[model samples]
Target: MTDALSQIRRIVSARTPEAVWHELAAALKPFGFDRILYGATSNRREGSVGDIQDVVSFTTIARHPGRGREDMSFFIRTPMFRWVMNNSGASSWRWAEEQFAKGLLTPDEVAARDLARKSGLCAGYVISFEEPGSRRAAALSMIAAPDQTQDSIDAMWAEKGDEIIILAQTMHLKIQSMPLKVHRRALSPRQREALEWVAEGKTSQDIAIIMGISPGMVEKHLRLARECLDVDTTAQAVAKAAMFNHLYANPTGEPKR
Candidate 1:
């Protein structure tokens, strides 16, 4: 168990978030969870816990065929997601099934269940973790293989629940620390620097002086940053950049001067 945990820690320390997910996926295969879907919403609004627009999520499930479409169209229809929104910590597919049997599921939710079963995601466990003092929540779903049964999964969890929780917590922490690529957009170094200065309440002229660049250049960087983040104004760009861990990134290359 110690060796496995050490390996997980090493993987979590990877330089890129994608690398961390890949390594974490490989590590989880031994525990009978071959498919993984991990997502987090860092900016959930109060009283809008289940609203999709209020949440920004990053996930690995897009790599699976058809899963991306399912997520976009049917996510809100899933009972599991609704349960996680109202509750925290760990839950299993059995809980969702119980809700279904009680006739508590909406029609859309029933359809979502059928879709999941058709897609071979019949049984699994989900762990939801919310950040302290914030509405930010992270959920990791460990999906069993098509051939695996609920009884087998239950026994495995009984034996290794602690290890599974430890792994999930470690991965969740690493994910929150990294910048996620939203809508296939990434921030360039100069843009990130400009946004960081803006977040520090610096004007374009002030940022220009700090980075030894012209005021025009500072404005240009901020403009490009706003475009990349798909925000209309510099303030919004700065806030979004900071939310994604883009601002104040460690010195990887020389800052534009």
Candidate 2:
């Protein structure tokens, strides 16, 4: 118990997202689950995780990117994705099976299940978390060991489900409190600073004065920020950056991975 507590403490205090993810995955390894995917969104719509660009996610599943980068947007069309967007609780992979048996699943959902079976991802647990804000949603998916059957995993869950849920919740909250950084799309210090100023309700001229630059230079910074964030306007850039904590990132520039 003391060792578990110590590990949990370390996980929460980890400075970087990579550290936290590695620790979290290590912690779950003994519980027969080694593959985990954590995803959270602050801009969810009725049945979506909102813009994929705005999602905060970490994964342990190896995508074999050397072959080809996986299209993560495909997750949006999966049954589990819809369930997380619509509900707030832990559910078994059995739910998907039952839905399929009852002929209640859509064609796309059935196809998703077939693919999961082919990929050895057929047995797992999904926890759709209840967030404090209406616009927020988070979920964690844990896949059992390849040698484990769905029935065996379910029996284990019955005995240790509460502990599993608590650990996942802790991980989600810890990740939320940490910095959000994306290696694929890191903003420059000037670009992030410009977005921060915009989020603070600063105009072009106001930001220019505050940043010690001309209005045209301020406009250029904001424009570059919008482009970096892949947003159509400064408002969208500010909203997206703030949502991901990019606005609060190190002005010294993101550290190398």
Candidate 3:
């Protein structure tokens, strides 16, 4: 078991979110499930209030018929998940709730019940992380069901909960380092300069002048940022970087740095 865990850690270190998602599904072979979805909560600002929503989900299946990634966005918002989040009966869930309730559940626990119901699931497990050093909390939800008895699968999940927790933490670290890896690869000195400014919410033209480059150059850096982060747009890249502390302009801006 220890050897398997070490191997899993190594795989996680070497992969993207997509790869990690599939690897996680494979690692969970002990539990007989037709589908697996790992959904992480969106990172929101402190004292900046709104719905505490989750975004950026990954999914895999085990010999089953269902919707693909596009279909996932709809199911993650179900009432069943909200009910479970509100009352999971798991010790970890209760602890997470207590922590978030006191100033927990960032953005104040988004009403995602509708999303959860759409997925057609019977059981769910949720876990939260502290984003390394910040008080900010991030949550992940995993839901499942299959021909195997619920009692049996629940037992497996309980026994393997610690392993899953370790996986989550390691996965979190990888995400937080993704941008730095990109920063080292293709970003030029001026491009990097523009990127840092961009990370701080500066416009392309603002970044261009700061880096003594053209707005076009700023646009180029934005494109690189998106490619490196494996996201679609500059805004997503920026949000991902800021939330994960993958890359930062001010050393003091991120809690761990």
- What lDDT does the true structure give each of the candidates? 0.74, 0.78, 0.51
Query: Per-residue lDDT tens digits of candidate 2, residues 48-139?
Result: 76677667777778665211113335455567777777888888888888888999888988887788789888788889999989889888
- How far does residue 3 in candidate 1 sit from its true spot (Å)? 2.8
**TM-score, candidate number 2:** 0.87
Give each model a TM-score.
0.85, 0.87, 0.52
Question: Which ranges of candidate 2 are over 4 A from the true structure?
Answer: 63-71, 182-184, 201-203, 251-257
Question: After best superposition, candidate 2 residue 130: deviation in angstroms?
Answer: 0.6
Clashing pairs in 1: none
The per-prediction tally of clashing pairs is: 0, 0, 12
Candidate 3 structure quality by residue, lDDT tens digits, 53-158: 2244455632443333343444334332344334322333233334445753433243443233354544546554554433333345555554554466557777
Where does candidate 2 clash, by residue pair?
none
Q: Which is better, 1 or 2, measured by TM-score?
A: 2
Model 1 misplaced regions, further than 4 Å: 46-73, 211-213, 251-257
Candidate 2: deviation at residue 10, Å?
1.7
Clashes in candidate 2: how many? 0
